[model samples]
Target: MIAFLTSCQEELDLDNPNAFSLEELLQTADGFELLAVGVMDSYQKIPANEFLLIDLRSDDSRANAQNGVYPDVDAYNMDTNNGDAATYWSNNYATIFRANSIIDNRFLAPEEYQYTIGEAYFFRALCHFNLVRAYRNVPYLDKVIDINSNEASNYPQLPPSEVYEKIIQDFRTSIAFLNGGPQNRYRPSEGAAICLLAKAFLSQPNPNYTEAELLLASVIENKESFGYDLLTIDRDDAVNFLFDADPNDPTVNVLTTEEYRANQAITFAKIFGNEFTGEFSSDNLRLDGTFSNNEGLEINEEIIFSIPYEAINTDNVASSQSGLDDQVETDAEGFSNAMTASGPSNGVNVATLDLLSLMTPELQPVRFDGTFRSITVIADDILNDTFNSKYHLLGKPMGTIGLF
Candidate 1:
C-alpha cells in the first residue's frame, strides 16, 4: 500500500525529442499561419512532377528523353509502384497530412484564428479532390496515421464518390471560416473557397450544376472585393513583337505594339515579356514598381493565384524559375544582375505544330479570340506559355463559370 501510494505521486512530463509537437505549435501566435504557409509552399514543389503526368500524356508533348520515369508516364505505362507515381502520390499526401493535423485539433486555436484553420481546410479539401480525380480509389486519411496503432496498414481506400463527399464537407468548413482577402496571392480566401467549391460540386457523380452556378456567380460578382481583376495593357507601354533584322523596314508585315494593345488582340504576349532582357529598361512586368520608372512595368492585375518565387537571384532567376510564374516578391536587384550575367531563355516543353496553330494568335473559346493563338516573335519561336492541356478536365468542370 505504501509503495503503490509512492508510485501514484510520481509524474512523467518528458518532452519529445524525436517528434514535433505540432498540436502545441498550432497554439502559438504565428504557428497557425506558418502551418498555412507551409501548405502553400509545398504546392510549389509539385508542378514539376504534376506537369509530367498531365503534359506528357497529351498530344501536345512527348518525353524529353527515353530515360528516367518520363518514358513511363509518357506512354501511360506507369504502375502504382512506379517511381513517378509513388513520388507524386507521396508529395500530395504529405500536404494532406499537415492539413489533417490542423483540422483534428480545431479547439486548440482561438476564435481569432479562424482564418488559419480555414486555409488548412481549403488546402486539405483541394488535396483530397485532386487525389480522387487522379488516383481514382485512394486511401482517404482523416487523421495522421499512428504507426504503432495499426491504422497505417488498415487505411480506408474508398471510391472517388466518397472522396468527393469528404472534399465537399471540408470545403463547407473552409467557406464558413475562410474570410478576409488572403495572407498572400498563394493563400486561399472566401472567394477561393467558393471557386473551388463550385468546381467540387460540378465534379461529383451526378453533378450539381445549380449549386455550382450559384457559387461561381457569387465569386464572379464580387471578385473585386476578393482582389481579382483583369489586367490591361497600355498602347504606349506595350513592347513590339517582331524579329526584324532591319528596324528601318516599314512595309515588312509584322505585329506591332498598337495591334497587341487593342481589346481584341491576344494577351499571350504577357508570358514572354522582356523579363529576360538584362537591361534596366526592360522587365515590362507591372508588379508595384519593382523596377524603375524607365523599366515600363507598372503592376500585375490579371493574375489571381500565381505562386511567387524569390527575387534574390541565385541559380534560378525569373527565367530559370521553370515554365511560368511571376516574381511576386519585388527584390529585382538580384533579378537585374542575374539577367545581365546570363541572357537565358524562358523556354519550356515544345508544343506540337498543330497545337501552336490552335492557340497562337489568341487564347481559346472562339468568342474570345477568333484569329491567332500567338504572335511570331521570331520565325520558329512564337512566344507561348505551356499550360498543361491534358488537364482540360480541370477546366471542363468549370462549364458554367466560363459562360457566365
Candidate 2:
C-alpha cells in the first residue's frame, strides 16, 4: 500500500503542461504589452476618489451635507481614518506596483516595446506625483516590493523634495523613451510626458518656471506634430443661421430668438459634438436629456489623455462594502458615483455657493448652460433651488475627460 501511494504521489508531482512561470511568460514583447495593460487597468482606480480629496477641499466645490462621509473633507478637517483618503493612497500604490513590474523587467522585453516601458514610467511618475502632492512626505516606490523580504522598509517615506526629484527623473526618462505622437489618446505619449514634466517642475517645492516655460513652448510650437489643437467653430458658418438673412449683409445687426438658439446649437455641437442632445426644442425650450454614453467629444483633438469608461448596466456596478477576504469587484467598466450620483441631496460632490454665484445663465450664457442645469424642490411650504453640475445628472455615466 505504501509503495502504491508513493507511485501516485510521484505521478501528481509531474509539471502541469498548462502552467507557465512569470519568467517564461515575460520573455516576449507581447508579455511586456500585457504588463503595460495591467498597469493601465490598475491606474483606472486612481481617479475613483480624487473628487473627495481635491475638489471637496477646494473653494469651488463642496460636499453634500447629507453625505456623512465627505462633510469632513469639505470642512478641511479630514483625518487619517477617512475612507476616501485611505482608498486614494492604496489605489496609487496599486498602480505603482503594476507599473514597476513593467519598468523593472523592461530589459527582458524586445526593443520594439520601449514605448510601453515609457508608458510605465509615466504612470509611475504620475502616481508618485499625486502622492507627494496629497500626502507631502511619501515613499517613492521605483520597484515592486517583495512580501517576504525587507523591501518595504528599504523605501521609507522620503521628504517632498526628494520625492519631487524622483518624479521629475521618471518623467524625463519617460520623455526619452516615448517617441513621436500619441497613437491612442487613451495612452501616454511624448507630448504627454513633456507636459507632465513641465507641470511637475511647477508643482515642486521650488518651482522651475524657466524650464517649464521652455517645455511648454516646445509643445505649443510642435502641437501639429503631436496631433493636438483646440476644437474650433466657424463664426461665419454659425451666423448663417440668423433668420435666413444674408450672413454677409451688414444690415442684419440683430438675431431673433430662434436664430440665436440655432447659433448656440451650432457652437454646442462643435464643442460637445452631435452625440449630445437636449440643448433646444422646436419651441425654443431647453429639454432635460442625457449625453450619449459613448465615445463622443472624447476623441476631439483638444483632449490630451483621458480615461475611458463604458455605460454598464446598474446591476453590474460593484458594491463598495464587499468582504475584505472576498474578491471586491469594481465598476471598472462604468463611471463612479462621484460623477454619476443623482443629485445634490444624494451626491457627495457638488458645486459650492461661491461657484454657483458665478455660474448663472446671465453671467456665463453658453458655458453655464452647457455644464450645469438648475432644479427647484419644495418641502414643507419652502422652496429650495439648486444648480446641478453636469456631473450630477442622472443616467449619465460619462467618465472623466481632461482637456489641455
Per-candidate Cα lDDT values, in order, are: 0.53, 0.65
| Cα RMSD for candidates in order | 11.0, 6.0
Model 1's TM-score against the true structure:
0.65
Local lDDT at 374 for model 2:
43
Candidate 1, residue 288: how far the Cα is off, in Å: 27
lDDT of 1 at 85: 62
Measured by TM-score, the strongest candidate is 2
lDDT of 1 by residue, 163-238 (tens): 8988898888888887664534446767767778888999888699999999877766886687555545556555
- What TM-score, over all chains together, does every model reach? 0.65, 0.78
Candidate 2 Cα outliers beyond 4 Å, as residue runs: 1-21, 239-241, 244-294, 315-329, 332-337, 341-345, 378-401
